[model samples]
Target: MAGACVAALLASSACSSSQDASPMSDSSASNASQKLSGTVTVFAAASLKESFTTLGADFEKAHPGTKVTFSFGGSDSLAASITGGAPTDVFAAASPRTMAVVSDAGGVSGTPTTFVRNQLEIATRPGNPDAIGSLEDLTDPKLKVVLCDRTVPCGAAAQKALDGSKLKLTPVSYEQDVKGALTKVVLKEADAAVVYKTDVRAAGDKVGGVEFPESADAVNDYPIALLKDAPNAAAAKAFIDYVQSAAGQKVLTSAGFLKP
Candidate 1:
């Protein structure tokens, strides 16, 4: 009887040890990995609205306990904000030049990676009432053209394109961001606006997009970096990694943004 009891006890101990050694279920593992909670503030260029917003949602879904908040505006303005002490976790600029502003100030932690590229386009009211066809059309004195402020990436790119075409033109208004420039056209406040192609696409039928060859001269390369003082550094790095992933590439390309 004693021998039989000892053998049974050994078998029970083995079963307990096996149970302890078993791997956690996939759901439990996911829950454990998703313990990253709290808000991740992202400052991205205005042009990245669609794709970045989609990625933010995906990131949230991937990390159930975490939340992503965004501040989208002109890249230069956003970079300034970061440098000026506006609390931010990630900074995604439309131009490396603008990002250099933050990098120069040591506002970010690591090297910024170029994630996407964009080109300028003329955004006009539906039907292009200005009869705008090329970059020189913007030189028409009678046209009330709006452009992104020269400080903004879109505006800087527009200047490059204009310089490349050797066309001297001036805009009636220099808005803070591409969206502001597009809004002027959408609201008929201006005849046209020099904005990013993505902005024109986002505006849909509200505006007509005119692609000029000179835009190639000012194709902007977007770069993203994690802020040095990121409140959520771990989640910030994870978000940046996700943005460079294949899934994120699909979302960005679907929005007409070029792969990096």
Candidate 2:
């Protein structure tokens, strides 16, 4: 009878141990899965500078001990760098065509997802000093106009809009990025520039924005993806998720970006 009682106690102890060793609770497992750390490096288009910077700051706050670094420039240039083996965690391009440049080169980890879309706008000097109101007005030889280089996404979109409207514009100079084109108007170096609507909004009182019907024809979709050899894949993916989350969308939409 004593031996029988000893076996019963041992079985009870074994059952208790089994219960204690059961799989972690769902919440515990989720928390363990979400733990992320390290710096996430992003190569992004110049147009994303303001919005992405805001999102990056919010991401860092949400994930303690993680950092987000950005290299903002023309999407084409950024894609070239990535394809050339530049070490980065993520790439956010201003347009699908530019994103394709990386994907075709096998520099991206997965399919690039479109996150937002942007439309072209005429950025003019403050208070309409040039009185420029339409795409045709830019054709006047008297205005000192600046345009993005045709190779850049913004420039390409502008060309599309012009072509759709059957309009031809000659600019005093061509800039390599949207920011460069907008800066010409902001500094009053150029009377007007064709840039992204978001860029005009970001400039605040520094420049005035003119919307033309043709802009609808030249809307550019922005895409984001993880690079093939990301050094910080976990953090990079977390940042990308945050960018697509409701909180991130709120910040981006509030900044004048259109939802994809």
Candidate 3:
């Protein structure tokens, strides 16, 4: 009887020890699997805010130990950051021209792939009381118009479209970026502004967007690439891959962005 009791106690101890170690072992493995751990700072164009935020969340969930930090602004500004060594891991520009600036400066790791396409839209206050229908209407002296500065991608596209139609518009303000241009229209500060289709979609009820036929002449391609000196190269590559993936494309498309 004594021997049997001792044997039973030993068996119980061994089982408990094994069970306890199993969870710890599993935890160690889990930590090890998350080798790509760090904050990857991404500089993306303003129009990409909504879609990039969603994708960032998905990336964090997929890679347990990774954190993504994004700076959303004009493509020109983003290009300046990467060119000036702003400690950015990735860059997503609204135009290939902007991306080329970085690539020319040797700031990019590899070739950038075009992820999405965007075009200009006429954004006005909800209801569009002015009865503005076409690009030529923006030139009306009574109507207050706003446009992005020539440096920004949306502004460049807007310029191209306006030039194609031979419409001369003297906007009240030349905004620094697409969001800034849209804000003028949303706040009713201006009757209309040329902004990206994605910006119009993200603005919700703040403004109404009118698709102009001339927009086809000014479509801009969004390109993304990893930086050469990325602090977290693995995570940067992974995030870039995610943006080009089918799932990422779906997210952008849902946000009203055109696929590349």
Total clashes in model 2, counting residue pairs 3 or more apart in sequence or in different chains: 0
Which tens-of-lDDT digit does each residue in 1-260 have in candidate 3? 99999999999999999999999999999977656778989999999988999999999999888899999998998898788879999999999999999999999998998999998899988988999888888999999999999999999999999899988889899998898999888888999999998899999998988889999989999989999999999889999999989999999999998978
Query: Which parts of model 1 have CA positions greater than 4 angstroms off?
Result: 1-16, 19-22, 25-34
Q: What does the lDDT come to for candidate 3?
A: 0.91
All candidates' lDDT scores? Answer: 0.90, 0.92, 0.91
- Residue 80, model 1: lDDT of 77
- Worst 10-residue stretch by lDDT in candidate 2? 18-27
Question: RMSD, each candidate, Å?
Answer: 2.5, 2.5, 4.9
> Which digits, one per residue and each the tens of the lDDT, describe model 1 over residues 84-103?
99999999999999999999
* Of 1 and 3, the candidate ranking higher by TM-score: 1
TM-scores for candidates 1 onward, in order: 0.91, 0.91, 0.87
**Which is better, 1 or 2, measured by lDDT?**
2
Better of 2 and 3 by TM-score: 2
Clashes in each model (backbone N, CA, C under 3 Å)?
0, 0, 0
Candidate 3 ranges beyond 4 A from true positions? 1-34
Ranking by TM-score: 2, 1, 3
- Model 2 residue pairs with clashes: none
lDDT for position 196 in model 1: 82
- Tell me the lDDT of model 1 at 160: 85
